[model samples]
Target: MFGDAADAMGGMGSQEDSLVQIGVLVPLSPPGWAEAGRQLLGGLELGVREVNAAGGIELQLLVRDTAADPRKAEAAVSELAQLGVAAVVGEYHSVAARAAAARADALGLPFLCSSAVLDALTEEPTDLVARIAPAQSHSWRIYADFLLAAGHHRIAVAAQTSVYWAAGTSILRDHLAARGGTVIELNDLTPAALCDELADSRATALLLLTGTPEPAVAIVRSVRRDARLAEVLIGAPAGQPELPAWAALLGQDGAGIPFLRYLPEVFSPLGARVDAALRETMSAEPSFVAFEGYDTITALAEYLRVGSWAAVSVEGTRGQIRFTRTPGVGVWQWAWPPAQVADRDPAAPDRFRVLHTA
Candidate 1:
C-alpha cells in the first residue's frame, strides 16, 4: 500500500512520500524514459510507506522532475538543500544523476543514486555521493561476455552523441577487444544509412547504443526491414528493451534483442514480498529499477543510523545489500546485484526470457 504521499505535481511542493522530507530527483516528463522514472517513483513510494509503518525514523520524499535535464537536476538539488532535505535520492538517467551528484556534493548534501549506472558518476570520489546500480563497466563487461558466448565476434554499436553512450561503447570495445572480438561504432548515421553501414561492416550483431524511440526505434525498424541484416542480432546493453515502451514501439522487431538487467535467478524472501507489493501497484511486472528504488530508501534508513555508506548492511529486495568501494568506482557502491542478459520472447512479446547471467 502506498503511504501518505506529497509530490510537487500534487501541489505538495516536491514530495511523493512524507516523513522526514527526502528529495527525490527523477525524470517524469518527455525526452526521458518516463516509464522507468514512474516505476522508480512507485518503488520509492512503497518503501517509504513500509518504513514508516515499521515505526522507524519517519522519512518524507520531495520529488522533483528532472525531465532528463542536467540543469533541472542541478537546480533541484539546490532547492532541496534549501528546503533542508536530509538527503537526495533517485534519478533514472545517468547524465542527470551525475549532474545531481555534483551539485549535491558542492552543497555537502548526501545523495544516493538509485538507478543510473555511469561508472564515473563524480569527477572525484566524495563521501557524500553513493550509488545502488551496478556500474556500466561491470554490467557491460558481462554483456560483452554474453556477446562472445553467442559467437558474435564482430559487433557494431549504432550510437548517438552522449557521455553515457560513449562510456558504454568504451566498455564494450575494451571488454570485447580483450576477448578477440571487434566492435565497430556507427555514429551520426541516419537509420537507413546505419543499416547500410551495419550490413557493410559484416558485424553479426548490432547493438542499439542510442536513446529511446527517436533514433533507437527508427534504427531497429530500418535494420529489421533490411534483409541483408536479417541474420544480425540486435542488442541493447543499456536496457531499452526491458521497458514496455520498446515493445509498444517495435513489437516483434523488439524481441530477441538481449539487454542487461539486474535480477537474481531466484528471489530472496524479501524480494518476493516486495515483488508482490510492486505488482499490486503496477499493471505489469516491475523491473529491477523499481527494486533499486525500494532498496535506496531501505539502505538510507540504515545509513542514517550508521552514518557510513560502507557500514550499510540491510536486507534489500534484491538480496543482502552491502556497500563497498569497487575498483574505478568513485562512490560507495553496492558491489552488484545479480546481473543477467534477458530479452523479450519472440513467441510472446510481453514475456521476457533470461538468456545469460553473470
Candidate 2:
C-alpha cells in the first residue's frame, strides 16, 4: 500500500541542499481522523513558513498519512527514516503513535508526538520519542480540580474500554476519591445506560472519558434528553473539546458542559494576531491539535537553530518543550503541553469561554 523510500520523497525537492527535512505523519483519510490531519498539516505548514520567513533554517516537510492505523503508522515511520528526515511530529491516535514511536526509536530518530494522550506512551526512557501533549493523568488532574472546585463531592464516571480511556478514567476516579470525593459509580456502559446511571446515582457531576468525540457527544445528547439529569454537571476530560466533531455534534446542548482544551486566549494580543493569521487560511477555528502541530515544528526548529537536539528546551504556543526521561510509560521521554477547561455559552452557541487553566 506504499512505495519505496525514494518514491516517498521523490516529489520533494532535492534534500542535498540547505533544506532540513522533517517528517510529518498524520491521518488524512476516513476512519483515520482526516479532519485532524488537515488541521495538523495546516499548523505544521504555517510554522515552517513563519520559521523560513524569519530566516531560520529552511524546512522541508516529508509528509506521510498514517491513516490512523497502527500498521500504517509503522510503515510511515519506516519510510520517513529511509528518506532520512531529521525529525518527526504529529500523530492523532495513541495506537498509531505507539507503533510509529517504536519504529522511530529503533532508527534513532527524534519524534515529537503531538496529540496522542495515553499515559503509557512515554513510560520507558529513550531519547528518540517525546510528546507535546500531556498524559491522561495530567489532563485528568485538571478535570479533578474543576470538579472539586465546583463542589462536586459525588461523581459518576463512565468511559470507553480502550487503554487510553481506561488509563484516564482510573486516574480521574482515584484522584477524586482520594480528595474526599465519592465515586458513586465508575464503569463503562452504552450511552443510554450511562444516562440511567447518571440520573440514578444522585451524583453532583458526571465525568465522562471516552476514546473519541462521538461517544462524548452521545453521552451529552443522552444527558440533554433525560429530564432527571437536569442539575447534574457534565465534565469531559482530555481533548474532547479540541475535536471539531464536538462543536458540530453538540450544538446548543454543549452549553454548561466543560471539557479540556489547549486554546490560547483569543482576545489577547499575541493570540489574536496568531489566530487571525490562521483563520485567514483555515476553514475551522484553530484547534489544540493545530497548535500542537505548530508548536512541535517550532520547538524542533528552535533546537535546530541552536545546532543541537541534545536536552533542548523551547517555549511554544502550548507551553514548554523539552525531553525529560519518563519511566513505566514507554521507551521515550515526554513533555506536556499547557491545557485549560472551556465551556460553550448557551446564550451564544458559537462562542466558548475558558474556565480554568492547567
Which candidate should be chosen as best, given lDDT against the real structure?
1
lDDT of 2 by residue, 120-220 (tens): 76445665567777776777788788889978888887766667666776787789888998876556677898887777788978877664456777888
Q: Tell me model 1's lDDT, rounded to 2 decimals.
A: 0.88
Lowest-scoring 10 consecutive residues by lDDT in candidate 1? 1-10
Clashes of 2: 5
- Clash number for candidate 1: 10
Instruction: Give lDDT for model 2.
Output: 0.73
lDDT tens readout by residue for model 1, 191-227: 8888888888989999988888778899989999999
Clashes per prediction? Answer: 10, 5
The TM-score obtained by model 2 is 0.86
